[model samples]
Target: MIEIDSRAFGNKIKNIRNSKHFSLRQVSNQSKDETGVAISPSYWSLVERGKRNIPKPQTLKRIAKGLRVDESDVFRMAGLEAPTEATNLTRITSSEMVSVPIIGEIACGEPITAIENVSGHMLLPNNLVKGGDYFILKCIGKSMEPTIMNDSNVLVRAQPDVENGQIAAVLLDDDTTATLKRIKKTKNSVILMPDNPDFEPIVLNEDKPGRIIGVVKMEMKMF
Candidate 1:
């Protein structure tokens, strides 16, 4: 049993949970229903935030089952090797998938209304999208490169706000245009930071007219 850093392990679990688009309540409910284990959301939150060590093996198995990921993978993420039998655990599959519309292209430069046109649709795994109204936008500039490249399709969850340091699709100048950028907030202004250092950050007054259209949840690269 390799020792795992509680904080690092917790962050890994948090990232996986978010990528799966699962809420703490959902995980807890599902785990209880499926595995007969009742892990509270508060305890899970503590586990995810590094306030607690990894749970016991049985509890970890229940958690893995609840998250719909391989038990072995969960153990591995915690810096422990799974028993040989655990490696053979079956994969989890959801009965339904979510369909997200691929909207028009969004400018990583001057900002364009990317949702004005519908290009096509994408079928995403139910676990990947959960329950939000999601849309896809094609990237049109290199300013967000190395993370969101030009021509890549980005999945955005329809929301009006995002936490600081999260990427969002922002509607600017009276909803006429939109851009994809990482959001940072100061007391006086909202800063749109580009991933590529070559691009300068765009700062708007806190009382600016722009609104957050949605948060960039995930990106799909175009081959």
Candidate 2:
């Protein structure tokens, strides 16, 4: 196991938090907005001070996004080296960004799915999202092709609710599923429609059950 110095990690967290001019409350609030996950300000303060150890990977991703830096950058700040940048044919803006780790791929109604171990990630704007939590995923299949494509990396802002017409990471039943489809509201149901016509739409009884995990705030095409 790679041993990380707790004190050094804390100092690095503090440095990044201060550098971004974000207070403990600000960080907690941003996290709540972005991830729909509640993080106490006092607890966050301890985490920043390195008084807290063993931060979850998802939490790390969120903190990196909130601080406008990459997870590798955060690792480096904590005395670990940053990972090499992934190559993509698509044009990337010169502005700094951080890569959120790809947990896996998800589908709306497929019986089978692809659940890969932490294979790769998608890059996103450092400050565009407010939540201190996020993760990336490579979209597969044509169910949401064209706009999302078969191999596009999508940056998901982890939250429970999503706005209309935005791509989202969604969960159906008990599966860890994700879709690059747009959200639309009907009088009786919520429809998850695809950009392409080859696939059908997913209709949910809004007043009853269903999960719209989060919105896809950013994407990078690789094909």
Model number with the top TM-score = 1
Stretches off by above 4 angstroms in model 2 are: 1-99, 105-117, 120-125, 128-131, 206-209, 221-223
Per-residue C-alpha lDDT of model 2 across residues 13-47, encoded as one tens digit per residue: 78878887777765664453233474677877788
lDDT of 2: 0.64
What TM-score, to 2 decimals, does candidate 2 have?
A: 0.46
Clashing pairs in 1: 112-178
What TM-score does candidate 1 get on C-alpha atoms?
A: 0.51
If scored against the real structure, what TM-score would every candidate get?
Answer: 0.51, 0.46
lDDT of each: 0.75, 0.64
Q: Report the C-alpha lDDT of model 1 over 44-143, residue by residue, as the tens digit.
A: 8999999988787777776785586887888887777775755645555545666677776444443333444566777766766777778887777877
lDDT of model 1 at residue 30?
A: 44
Model 1 steric clash total:
1
Poorest 10 consecutive residues by lDDT, candidate 2: 108-117
